[model samples]
Target: MSRVCELTGKGPMSGNTISHANNKTRRRFLPNLNEVTLMSDALGQSFKLRISAAALRSVDHRGGLDGYLAKAKDDELSSNALKIKKEIAKAQAAA
Candidate 1:
């Protein structure tokens, strides 16, 4: 899989590596991505996702996966995550 944060849609960013002699070299700054299994309270299921460290903190701050997904922008989510978000919404609505 590519080095991208599934939850945040964070990908490698292009930049420059400056040397002491003021030489600039092209470089890529990648997000701190990790594979984590997060639980959904609404669906009572767990899903594994590759996400950034910042996104992980946001997930916790929002109370969990369900909450974060509720507030997340649809375009930022991967297809798999979008499906889970919809399922959680459906389950919550049915409850």
Candidate 2:
């Protein structure tokens, strides 16, 4: 998958690196991502994703890695497990 934070919609950002010497260069800002395994209570299984540290912290604060994911909506590609995760993430932001 791409280097993106699924929950926060964070990805690589390009910018200029300014130096104290009044020089500028190219720079890239990448989100703090971690490979995490979220569980799907609905499916009684687990899945993984590369999410931002903030997202992980949010999920953890709401519950646990798997606990939160246990809540997203099930659609075409959104399996019961995925839906649970999405739901939990949404709920976290609202809170």
Candidate 3:
């Protein structure tokens, strides 16, 4: 897989790496990504997703990611992805 956060849609960022001598070099800023097995409630199974730390935080900030997975485990959007639509729905309900 590419150096990206599939969950958060985070991709490589272009930037400059400055040296102590005031020299600058082109570099890429990558997100903190982890390969984790996320549970899908709808499919009654677990799927792997390459997600960034920020993305994980976003999910966690809204109550709990575990709760979202638990709720989704019983739905058809259980595998492959946690499902953007379901997450939006949950967020709206909480609001």
Model 2: per-residue lDDT, tens digit, 1-95?
A: 67777655668999999999979999999889898887644445566767788888877786765554444223312243355566656665666
Q: In every candidate, how many clashes are there?
A: 0, 6, 8
- Report, for every candidate in turn, its global Cα lDDT versus the true structure: 0.95, 0.65, 0.62
Off by over 4 Å in 3: 63-95
The local lDDT score (0 to 100) that residue 29 gets in candidate 1 is 99
Q: Put down candidate 3 lDDT per residue, 1-95, tens digits, no spaces.
A: 68776555568899999999989999998888898776544334565778888766766765555554444433333234556445545655676
* Candidate 3 residue pairs in clash (backbone atoms < 3 Å): 40-73, 41-72, 41-73, 41-74, 42-72, 42-73, 42-74, 42-75
TM-score quality measure for candidate 3: 0.62
The residue ranges of model 1 lying beyond 4 angstroms of the native Cα positions read none
Considering every candidate listed, which one attains the maximal lDDT? 1
Best by TM-score: 1
* Clash-forming residue pairs, model 1: none
Answer with 1 or 3, whichever has the higher TM-score.
1
Error of 1 at 76 (Å): 0.5
TM-score of 2: 0.62
